[model samples]
Target: MEFADRVILVTGASSGLGRHAARALALAGATVVLLGRHEKRLDGVYDDILAAGGAQPVIMPFDLAEADDPRFNALAATLAHQLGRLDGILHSAAQFIKLSKLEHQRLKHWEAAFATNLMAPFALTRACLPLLEGAEDAAVLFSAEEHGLNPGPYWGGFGLSQAALIALAELFAAEHQDNPNLRFNVLIPGPVSSPMRHRTHPGEVPENLPKPESLLPFYLTWLGPQSRGRSGEVIRPDLGYDPSRQD
Candidate 1:
Protein backbone atom coordinates (compact mmCIF):
# COMPACT_ATOMS: atom_id res chain seq x y z
CA MET A 1 0.00 0.00 0.00
CA GLU A 2 2.70 2.44 -0.99
CA PHE A 3 0.16 5.04 -2.05
CA ALA A 4 -2.32 4.39 0.76
CA ASP A 5 -4.37 7.45 1.61
CA ARG A 6 -3.13 9.43 -1.39
CA VAL A 7 -5.22 10.45 -4.38
CA ILE A 8 -4.12 9.81 -7.94
CA LEU A 9 -5.89 10.62 -11.18
CA VAL A 10 -5.07 8.95 -14.48
CA THR A 11 -6.28 9.84 -17.94
CA GLY A 12 -6.63 7.10 -20.59
CA ALA A 13 -7.38 4.68 -17.81
CA SER A 14 -9.30 2.41 -20.17
CA SER A 15 -6.29 0.83 -21.85
CA GLY A 16 -2.60 0.60 -22.72
CA LEU A 17 0.04 2.45 -20.69
CA GLY A 18 -2.54 4.39 -18.71
CA ARG A 19 -4.27 1.21 -17.64
CA HIS A 20 -1.02 -0.29 -16.41
CA ALA A 21 -0.08 2.81 -14.46
CA ALA A 22 -3.55 3.22 -12.99
CA ARG A 23 -3.75 -0.43 -12.00
CA ALA A 24 -0.30 -0.35 -10.45
CA LEU A 25 -1.05 2.73 -8.40
CA ALA A 26 -4.47 1.44 -7.36
CA LEU A 27 -2.95 -1.85 -6.25
CA ALA A 28 -0.58 0.17 -4.09
CA GLY A 29 -3.69 1.59 -2.33
CA ALA A 30 -4.16 4.98 -3.99
CA THR A 31 -7.70 6.27 -4.42
CA VAL A 32 -7.32 6.37 -8.19
CA VAL A 33 -9.66 8.46 -10.28
CA LEU A 34 -10.02 7.12 -13.81
CA LEU A 35 -10.76 9.63 -16.53
CA GLY A 36 -11.75 8.50 -19.99
CA ARG A 37 -14.40 8.98 -22.66
CA HIS A 38 -16.03 5.58 -22.46
CA GLU A 39 -17.92 4.93 -19.28
CA LYS A 40 -18.35 1.23 -19.98
CA ARG A 41 -14.66 0.67 -20.59
CA LEU A 42 -13.75 2.76 -17.60
CA ASP A 43 -16.11 0.70 -15.47
CA GLY A 44 -14.44 -2.48 -16.69
CA VAL A 45 -11.05 -1.18 -15.61
CA TYR A 46 -12.51 -0.05 -12.32
CA ASP A 47 -13.88 -3.53 -11.82
CA ASP A 48 -10.48 -5.02 -12.54
CA ILE A 49 -9.02 -2.91 -9.74
CA LEU A 50 -11.73 -4.07 -7.35
CA ALA A 51 -11.18 -7.70 -8.33
CA ALA A 52 -7.46 -7.33 -7.70
CA GLY A 53 -8.28 -6.04 -4.22
CA GLY A 54 -6.81 -2.67 -5.13
CA ALA A 55 -8.31 0.49 -3.75
CA GLN A 56 -11.59 1.06 -5.57
CA PRO A 57 -11.13 3.73 -8.21
CA VAL A 58 -13.58 6.39 -9.24
CA ILE A 59 -14.37 6.90 -12.91
CA MET A 60 -14.81 10.28 -14.53
CA PRO A 61 -16.00 9.95 -18.12
CA PHE A 62 -14.92 12.92 -20.16
CA ASP A 63 -14.07 13.76 -23.72
CA LEU A 64 -11.18 16.14 -23.35
CA ALA A 65 -11.41 17.35 -26.91
CA GLU A 66 -14.95 18.58 -26.42
CA ALA A 67 -14.78 19.49 -22.75
CA ASP A 68 -14.32 23.13 -21.93
CA ASP A 69 -11.81 24.56 -19.48
CA PRO A 70 -14.49 24.80 -16.80
CA ARG A 71 -15.09 21.08 -17.08
CA PHE A 72 -11.54 20.40 -16.05
CA ASN A 73 -11.65 23.03 -13.34
CA ALA A 74 -14.87 21.60 -12.00
CA LEU A 75 -13.29 18.17 -11.80
CA ALA A 76 -10.28 19.48 -9.90
CA ALA A 77 -12.37 21.71 -7.69
CA THR A 78 -14.59 18.76 -6.90
CA LEU A 79 -11.56 16.70 -5.94
CA ALA A 80 -10.23 19.51 -3.80
CA HIS A 81 -13.59 19.94 -2.14
CA GLN A 82 -14.00 16.25 -1.46
CA LEU A 83 -10.48 14.82 -1.14
CA GLY A 84 -8.78 17.95 0.19
CA ARG A 85 -5.96 17.72 -2.42
CA LEU A 86 -4.57 15.78 -5.33
CA ASP A 87 -1.41 13.78 -4.71
CA GLY A 88 -0.69 12.72 -8.27
CA ILE A 89 -1.91 13.00 -11.87
CA LEU A 90 -0.91 11.17 -15.03
CA HIS A 91 -1.68 12.57 -18.48
CA SER A 92 -1.61 9.29 -20.33
CA ALA A 93 -4.60 9.76 -22.61
CA ALA A 94 -3.82 9.98 -26.34
CA GLN A 95 -5.41 9.65 -29.78
CA PHE A 96 -3.39 7.48 -32.15
CA ILE A 97 -5.61 7.04 -35.15
CA LYS A 98 -4.37 7.48 -38.70
CA LEU A 99 -0.71 8.16 -39.38
CA SER A 100 -1.34 9.95 -42.68
CA LYS A 101 1.08 12.17 -44.50
CA LEU A 102 0.87 15.78 -43.37
CA GLU A 103 -0.94 16.78 -46.53
CA HIS A 104 -3.34 13.88 -46.26
CA GLN A 105 -4.05 14.09 -42.58
CA ARG A 106 -7.54 15.29 -41.79
CA LEU A 107 -7.60 18.67 -40.09
CA LYS A 108 -10.24 17.39 -37.70
CA HIS A 109 -8.03 14.51 -36.57
CA TRP A 110 -5.06 16.81 -36.08
CA GLU A 111 -7.08 19.33 -34.11
CA ALA A 112 -8.71 16.68 -31.92
CA ALA A 113 -5.37 15.05 -31.31
CA PHE A 114 -3.82 18.31 -30.24
CA ALA A 115 -6.84 19.16 -28.14
CA THR A 116 -6.89 15.86 -26.30
CA ASN A 117 -3.18 15.13 -26.16
CA LEU A 118 -1.71 18.60 -25.59
CA MET A 119 -4.31 21.19 -24.76
CA ALA A 120 -6.23 19.01 -22.35
CA PRO A 121 -3.15 18.14 -20.33
CA PHE A 122 -2.28 21.81 -20.06
CA ALA A 123 -5.77 22.76 -18.99
CA LEU A 124 -6.17 19.95 -16.49
CA THR A 125 -2.71 20.44 -15.02
CA ARG A 126 -3.26 24.14 -14.65
CA ALA A 127 -6.64 23.57 -13.05
CA CYS A 128 -5.20 21.11 -10.55
CA LEU A 129 -2.05 23.11 -9.86
CA PRO A 130 -3.13 24.56 -6.54
CA LEU A 131 -4.36 21.27 -5.21
CA LEU A 132 -1.23 19.49 -6.37
CA GLU A 133 0.96 21.99 -4.55
CA GLY A 134 -0.99 21.29 -1.39
CA ALA A 135 0.18 17.68 -1.34
CA GLU A 136 3.26 16.83 0.71
CA ASP A 137 4.69 15.11 -2.40
CA ALA A 138 2.92 15.61 -5.69
CA ALA A 139 3.70 14.33 -9.16
CA VAL A 140 2.42 15.23 -12.64
CA LEU A 141 3.61 12.85 -15.32
CA PHE A 142 2.88 13.07 -19.05
CA SER A 143 3.40 10.56 -21.83
CA ALA A 144 5.80 11.06 -24.74
CA GLU A 145 7.13 9.16 -27.71
CA GLU A 146 10.70 7.88 -27.69
CA HIS A 147 13.29 10.60 -28.10
CA GLY A 148 15.41 10.75 -31.28
CA LEU A 149 12.79 8.94 -33.31
CA ASN A 150 11.91 10.91 -36.41
CA PRO A 151 8.31 10.30 -37.29
CA GLY A 152 7.70 9.63 -40.95
CA PRO A 153 4.97 10.80 -43.29
CA TYR A 154 2.68 8.09 -41.97
CA TRP A 155 3.02 9.37 -38.40
CA GLY A 156 1.49 12.79 -38.87
CA GLY A 157 -1.16 13.63 -36.30
CA PHE A 158 0.04 11.30 -33.59
CA GLY A 159 3.65 12.33 -34.07
CA LEU A 160 2.88 16.02 -33.97
CA SER A 161 0.80 15.55 -30.82
CA GLN A 162 3.60 13.65 -29.12
CA ALA A 163 6.04 16.44 -29.96
CA ALA A 164 3.66 18.99 -28.51
CA LEU A 165 3.21 17.02 -25.27
CA ILE A 166 6.99 16.75 -24.87
CA ALA A 167 7.36 20.48 -25.31
CA LEU A 168 4.58 21.06 -22.79
CA ALA A 169 6.27 18.76 -20.29
CA GLU A 170 9.56 20.66 -20.68
CA LEU A 171 7.82 23.97 -20.19
CA PHE A 172 5.97 22.81 -17.07
CA ALA A 173 9.12 21.33 -15.56
CA ALA A 174 11.11 24.54 -16.15
CA GLU A 175 8.43 26.70 -14.58
CA HIS A 176 7.81 24.50 -11.51
CA GLN A 177 11.33 23.48 -10.45
CA ASP A 178 11.53 25.91 -7.53
CA ASN A 179 8.28 24.53 -6.10
CA PRO A 180 9.27 22.05 -3.41
CA ASN A 181 6.66 19.33 -3.73
CA LEU A 182 5.88 19.35 -7.45
CA ARG A 183 7.53 16.95 -9.88
CA PHE A 184 6.73 16.70 -13.59
CA ASN A 185 8.10 14.10 -15.97
CA VAL A 186 7.45 12.60 -19.41
CA LEU A 187 7.33 8.83 -19.91
CA ILE A 188 7.77 6.80 -23.11
CA PRO A 189 6.04 3.45 -23.31
CA GLY A 190 7.62 1.97 -26.39
CA PRO A 191 6.01 -0.75 -28.46
CA VAL A 192 3.92 -2.30 -25.78
CA SER A 193 1.48 -4.86 -27.22
CA SER A 194 -1.65 -2.81 -26.84
CA PRO A 195 -4.72 -2.00 -28.90
CA MET A 196 -3.08 1.19 -30.04
CA ARG A 197 0.03 -0.73 -30.98
CA HIS A 198 -2.04 -3.23 -32.91
CA ARG A 199 -3.65 -0.37 -34.76
CA THR A 200 -0.26 1.11 -35.55
CA HIS A 201 1.59 -2.02 -36.57
CA PRO A 202 -0.94 -4.50 -37.79
CA GLY A 203 1.57 -6.77 -39.49
CA GLU A 204 3.84 -7.21 -36.52
CA VAL A 205 3.61 -10.41 -34.48
CA PRO A 206 2.07 -9.61 -31.12
CA GLU A 207 3.89 -12.46 -29.38
CA ASN A 208 7.26 -10.78 -29.82
CA LEU A 209 6.14 -7.58 -28.08
CA PRO A 210 6.20 -6.99 -24.35
CA LYS A 211 2.91 -6.92 -22.52
CA PRO A 212 1.60 -3.65 -21.08
CA GLU A 213 1.71 -5.11 -17.56
CA SER A 214 5.47 -5.48 -17.92
CA LEU A 215 5.88 -1.81 -17.10
CA LEU A 216 4.61 -2.11 -13.51
CA PRO A 217 7.88 -1.49 -11.70
CA PHE A 218 8.50 1.78 -13.50
CA TYR A 219 4.89 2.75 -13.03
CA LEU A 220 5.03 2.07 -9.28
CA THR A 221 8.29 3.93 -8.85
CA TRP A 222 7.23 6.97 -10.82
CA LEU A 223 3.79 7.17 -9.21
CA GLY A 224 4.83 6.69 -5.57
CA PRO A 225 6.62 8.93 -3.09
CA GLN A 226 9.92 7.43 -4.20
CA SER A 227 9.83 9.75 -7.22
CA ARG A 228 9.35 12.94 -5.21
CA GLY A 229 12.58 14.51 -6.46
CA ARG A 230 12.36 13.31 -10.06
CA SER A 231 11.20 16.15 -12.24
CA GLY A 232 11.65 16.92 -15.93
CA GLU A 233 13.13 13.49 -16.49
CA VAL A 234 12.25 11.69 -19.74
CA ILE A 235 11.58 8.25 -18.30
CA ARG A 236 11.54 4.98 -20.22
CA PRO A 237 11.11 1.56 -18.65
CA ASP A 238 12.72 0.17 -21.79
CA LEU A 239 15.89 2.13 -21.01
CA GLY A 240 16.09 2.45 -17.20
CA TYR A 241 15.32 -1.22 -16.47
CA ASP A 242 14.37 -4.40 -18.22
CA PRO A 243 10.63 -4.83 -17.92
CA SER A 244 11.03 -8.61 -18.00
CA ARG A 245 13.06 -8.58 -14.79
CA GLN A 246 12.69 -5.31 -12.93
CA ASP A 247 15.23 -4.76 -10.11
Candidate 2:
Protein backbone atom coordinates (compact mmCIF):
# COMPACT_ATOMS: atom_id res chain seq x y z
CA MET A 1 0.00 0.00 0.00
CA GLU A 2 2.46 2.64 -1.10
CA PHE A 3 -0.26 5.26 -1.54
CA ALA A 4 -2.85 3.99 0.89
CA ASP A 5 -4.64 7.24 1.61
CA ARG A 6 -3.75 9.05 -1.59
CA VAL A 7 -6.25 9.92 -4.32
CA ILE A 8 -5.32 10.11 -8.00
CA LEU A 9 -7.40 10.99 -11.06
CA VAL A 10 -6.66 9.28 -14.40
CA THR A 11 -8.56 10.43 -17.47
CA GLY A 12 -9.21 8.20 -20.52
CA ALA A 13 -9.03 5.12 -18.30
CA SER A 14 -11.23 2.86 -20.45
CA SER A 15 -8.32 1.40 -22.39
CA GLY A 16 -4.79 1.98 -23.60
CA LEU A 17 -2.18 3.43 -21.22
CA GLY A 18 -4.79 5.08 -19.02
CA ARG A 19 -6.36 1.72 -18.18
CA HIS A 20 -2.98 0.23 -17.32
CA ALA A 21 -2.03 3.27 -15.26
CA ALA A 22 -5.29 3.10 -13.28
CA ARG A 23 -4.69 -0.55 -12.44
CA ALA A 24 -1.07 0.07 -11.53
CA LEU A 25 -1.92 2.97 -9.23
CA ALA A 26 -4.76 1.04 -7.59
CA LEU A 27 -2.52 -1.96 -6.91
CA ALA A 28 -0.11 0.38 -5.15
CA GLY A 29 -3.06 1.36 -2.90
CA ALA A 30 -4.22 4.70 -4.24
CA THR A 31 -7.90 5.51 -4.56
CA VAL A 32 -7.97 5.66 -8.35
CA VAL A 33 -10.58 7.77 -10.14
CA LEU A 34 -11.24 6.31 -13.60
CA LEU A 35 -12.53 8.90 -16.08
CA GLY A 36 -13.52 8.05 -19.64
CA ARG A 37 -16.41 8.30 -22.03
CA HIS A 38 -17.23 4.60 -22.07
CA GLU A 39 -19.23 3.89 -18.94
CA LYS A 40 -19.29 0.13 -19.48
CA ARG A 41 -15.55 -0.13 -19.99
CA LEU A 42 -14.84 2.18 -17.08
CA ASP A 43 -17.12 0.08 -14.86
CA GLY A 44 -15.29 -3.08 -15.88
CA VAL A 45 -11.92 -1.61 -14.91
CA TYR A 46 -13.38 -0.45 -11.58
CA ASP A 47 -14.82 -3.91 -10.93
CA ASP A 48 -11.54 -5.58 -11.78
CA ILE A 49 -9.64 -3.28 -9.46
CA LEU A 50 -12.02 -4.09 -6.60
CA ALA A 51 -11.90 -7.81 -7.42
CA ALA A 52 -8.13 -7.67 -7.19
CA GLY A 53 -8.47 -6.46 -3.57
CA GLY A 54 -7.29 -3.00 -4.40
CA ALA A 55 -9.12 0.15 -3.38
CA GLN A 56 -12.68 0.38 -4.73
CA PRO A 57 -12.01 2.85 -7.54
CA VAL A 58 -14.25 5.71 -8.55
CA ILE A 59 -15.59 5.72 -12.13
CA MET A 60 -16.11 9.10 -13.80
CA PRO A 61 -17.52 8.65 -17.31
CA PHE A 62 -16.76 11.75 -19.33
CA ASP A 63 -15.94 12.30 -22.98
CA LEU A 64 -12.88 14.53 -23.03
CA ALA A 65 -13.86 15.68 -26.50
CA GLU A 66 -17.06 17.17 -25.13
CA ALA A 67 -15.86 18.58 -21.80
CA ASP A 68 -17.13 22.04 -20.97
CA ASP A 69 -16.83 24.49 -18.09
CA PRO A 70 -19.92 23.17 -16.32
CA ARG A 71 -18.62 19.61 -16.52
CA PHE A 72 -15.43 20.65 -14.74
CA ASN A 73 -17.27 22.60 -12.06
CA ALA A 74 -19.56 19.64 -11.41
CA LEU A 75 -16.67 17.22 -11.32
CA ALA A 76 -14.84 19.45 -8.87
CA ALA A 77 -17.88 19.52 -6.59
CA THR A 78 -18.26 15.76 -6.85
CA LEU A 79 -14.61 15.13 -6.02
CA ALA A 80 -14.69 17.66 -3.23
CA HIS A 81 -17.59 15.85 -1.60
CA GLN A 82 -16.30 12.34 -2.17
CA LEU A 83 -12.54 12.63 -1.64
CA GLY A 84 -12.10 16.14 -0.13
CA ARG A 85 -8.75 16.55 -1.89
CA LEU A 86 -6.83 15.17 -4.85
CA ASP A 87 -3.22 14.03 -4.48
CA GLY A 88 -2.53 13.78 -8.21
CA ILE A 89 -3.98 14.17 -11.71
CA LEU A 90 -2.79 12.42 -14.89
CA HIS A 91 -3.99 13.86 -18.19
CA SER A 92 -3.23 10.60 -19.91
CA ALA A 93 -6.46 10.84 -21.86
CA ALA A 94 -5.61 11.87 -25.44
CA GLN A 95 -7.19 11.60 -28.86
CA PHE A 96 -4.55 10.59 -31.39
CA ILE A 97 -5.51 12.77 -34.36
CA LYS A 98 -3.59 11.20 -37.18
CA LEU A 99 -1.16 12.41 -39.84
CA SER A 100 -2.43 15.04 -42.23
CA LYS A 101 -0.79 18.02 -43.85
CA LEU A 102 -1.73 21.47 -42.44
CA GLU A 103 -3.27 22.54 -45.77
CA HIS A 104 -5.38 19.40 -46.01
CA GLN A 105 -6.68 19.55 -42.38
CA ARG A 106 -10.33 20.43 -41.73
CA LEU A 107 -11.43 22.97 -39.14
CA LYS A 108 -13.42 20.29 -37.28
CA HIS A 109 -10.37 18.08 -37.04
CA TRP A 110 -8.35 20.92 -35.61
CA GLU A 111 -11.20 21.76 -33.20
CA ALA A 112 -11.32 18.14 -32.05
CA ALA A 113 -7.58 18.15 -31.45
CA PHE A 114 -7.75 21.25 -29.31
CA ALA A 115 -10.71 19.78 -27.48
CA THR A 116 -9.21 16.41 -26.68
CA ASN A 117 -5.46 16.97 -26.90
CA LEU A 118 -5.32 20.42 -25.33
CA MET A 119 -8.47 22.04 -23.93
CA ALA A 120 -9.54 19.00 -21.94
CA PRO A 121 -6.36 19.12 -19.86
CA PHE A 122 -6.48 22.89 -19.55
CA ALA A 123 -10.05 22.82 -18.25
CA LEU A 124 -9.62 19.87 -15.94
CA THR A 125 -6.32 21.17 -14.54
CA ARG A 126 -7.89 24.54 -13.85
CA ALA A 127 -11.01 23.08 -12.25
CA CYS A 128 -8.97 20.68 -10.15
CA LEU A 129 -6.47 23.36 -9.14
CA PRO A 130 -8.45 24.41 -6.08
CA LEU A 131 -8.91 20.82 -4.90
CA LEU A 132 -5.25 20.16 -5.55
CA GLU A 133 -4.35 23.17 -3.42
CA GLY A 134 -6.12 21.41 -0.57
CA ALA A 135 -3.65 18.55 -0.71
CA GLU A 136 -0.59 18.45 1.56
CA ASP A 137 1.52 17.32 -1.41
CA ALA A 138 0.40 16.80 -4.99
CA ALA A 139 1.49 16.37 -8.61
CA VAL A 140 0.00 17.32 -11.97
CA LEU A 141 1.33 15.02 -14.69
CA PHE A 142 0.63 15.57 -18.39
CA SER A 143 1.10 12.85 -21.00
CA ALA A 144 3.29 14.44 -23.68
CA GLU A 145 5.11 13.18 -26.76
CA GLU A 146 8.43 14.17 -28.38
CA HIS A 147 7.75 17.54 -29.96
CA GLY A 148 9.46 20.89 -30.76
CA LEU A 149 12.78 19.00 -30.93
CA ASN A 150 11.52 16.99 -33.93
CA PRO A 151 8.92 19.05 -35.66
CA GLY A 152 7.50 17.81 -38.95
CA PRO A 153 4.51 18.56 -41.19
CA TYR A 154 2.44 15.32 -41.15
CA TRP A 155 1.56 15.50 -37.39
CA GLY A 156 -0.93 18.35 -38.05
CA GLY A 157 -3.62 18.37 -35.35
CA PHE A 158 -2.24 16.12 -32.59
CA GLY A 159 1.27 17.38 -33.11
CA LEU A 160 0.28 21.01 -32.92
CA SER A 161 -1.85 20.39 -29.80
CA GLN A 162 0.97 18.43 -28.15
CA ALA A 163 3.36 21.32 -28.75
CA ALA A 164 0.80 23.54 -27.04
CA LEU A 165 0.31 20.98 -24.26
CA ILE A 166 4.04 20.75 -23.55
CA ALA A 167 4.20 24.54 -23.37
CA LEU A 168 1.19 24.49 -21.03
CA ALA A 169 3.05 22.16 -18.65
CA GLU A 170 5.88 24.65 -18.37
CA LEU A 171 3.45 27.53 -18.05
CA PHE A 172 1.79 25.84 -15.10
CA ALA A 173 5.11 24.67 -13.67
CA ALA A 174 6.44 28.22 -13.70
CA GLU A 175 3.31 29.59 -12.03
CA HIS A 176 3.08 26.87 -9.35
CA GLN A 177 6.74 25.96 -8.60
CA ASP A 178 6.81 28.66 -5.92
CA ASN A 179 4.21 26.72 -3.97
CA PRO A 180 5.73 24.07 -1.71
CA ASN A 181 2.63 21.85 -1.80
CA LEU A 182 2.41 21.11 -5.51
CA ARG A 183 4.58 20.16 -8.50
CA PHE A 184 3.88 20.04 -12.26
CA ASN A 185 5.64 18.19 -15.10
CA VAL A 186 5.30 16.64 -18.55
CA LEU A 187 5.73 12.83 -18.97
CA ILE A 188 6.65 11.64 -22.45
CA PRO A 189 5.93 7.90 -22.74
CA GLY A 190 7.94 7.55 -25.93
CA PRO A 191 6.80 4.89 -28.42
CA VAL A 192 4.50 2.42 -26.70
CA SER A 193 2.22 -0.33 -28.03
CA SER A 194 -1.09 1.47 -27.67
CA PRO A 195 -4.16 1.96 -29.88
CA MET A 196 -3.05 5.54 -30.36
CA ARG A 197 0.39 4.36 -31.38
CA HIS A 198 -1.11 2.02 -33.92
CA ARG A 199 -3.24 4.86 -35.28
CA THR A 200 -0.17 7.01 -35.57
CA HIS A 201 1.90 4.27 -37.14
CA PRO A 202 -0.47 1.70 -38.60
CA GLY A 203 2.27 -0.11 -40.49
CA GLU A 204 4.38 -1.13 -37.49
CA VAL A 205 4.13 -4.57 -35.85
CA PRO A 206 2.68 -4.07 -32.34
CA GLU A 207 5.05 -6.48 -30.57
CA ASN A 208 8.05 -4.35 -31.43
CA LEU A 209 7.08 -1.65 -28.92
CA PRO A 210 6.88 -1.78 -25.14
CA LYS A 211 3.50 -2.60 -23.62
CA PRO A 212 1.57 -0.11 -21.50
CA GLU A 213 2.29 -2.09 -18.32
CA SER A 214 6.02 -1.70 -18.88
CA LEU A 215 5.65 2.08 -18.54
CA LEU A 216 3.99 1.95 -15.10
CA PRO A 217 7.21 2.02 -13.11
CA PHE A 218 8.03 5.44 -14.52
CA TYR A 219 4.44 6.58 -14.06
CA LEU A 220 4.52 5.45 -10.44
CA THR A 221 7.70 7.39 -9.82
CA TRP A 222 6.13 10.64 -11.02
CA LEU A 223 2.70 10.14 -9.42
CA GLY A 224 4.18 9.13 -6.07
CA PRO A 225 6.11 11.33 -3.66
CA GLN A 226 9.47 9.98 -4.83
CA SER A 227 9.76 12.70 -7.47
CA ARG A 228 8.85 15.46 -5.02
CA GLY A 229 11.74 17.81 -5.71
CA ARG A 230 11.27 17.58 -9.47
CA SER A 231 9.10 19.99 -11.44
CA GLY A 232 9.09 21.21 -15.06
CA GLU A 233 11.32 18.32 -16.16
CA VAL A 234 10.20 16.25 -19.14
CA ILE A 235 10.54 12.58 -18.03
CA ARG A 236 11.38 10.17 -20.79
CA PRO A 237 10.44 6.56 -19.95
CA ASP A 238 13.28 5.25 -22.12
CA LEU A 239 16.20 4.28 -19.88
CA GLY A 240 18.49 5.00 -22.82
CA TYR A 241 17.42 8.62 -22.45
CA ASP A 242 19.40 9.03 -19.20
CA PRO A 243 21.23 12.35 -19.07
CA SER A 244 24.23 10.71 -17.34
CA ARG A 245 24.63 8.41 -20.33
CA GLN A 246 24.81 11.33 -22.75
CA ASP A 247 28.21 11.25 -24.46
lDDT of each: 0.84, 0.86
Off-target runs (Cα >4 Å) in candidate 2 are: 239-247
lDDT per residue as tens, model 1, 12-47: 999888988898899899999999999999999999
Candidate number of the best lDDT:
2
User: Looking at model 2, which ten-residue stretch has the lowest summed lDDT?
Assistant: 238-247
Instruction: Name every residue pair that clashes in candidate 1.
Output: 99-154
Count steric clashes of candidate 1: 1
Q: How would you encode candidate 2's per-residue C-alpha lDDT over 1-247 as one tens digit per residue?
A: 7778999999988888988899989999999999998899999999888888888899998888887899988998899999888999989888766687788888888898889878999999999999888898898899987853355788877788888999898999999988878888888888788888888877777776778878899889888889886888888777332322213
TM-score of each candidate structure, all chains considered together? 0.93, 0.94
RMSD of each: 3.5, 3.8
Compared with the true structure, the alpha-carbon lDDT of candidate 1 equals 0.84
What's the count of clashing pairs in each model shown?
1, 0
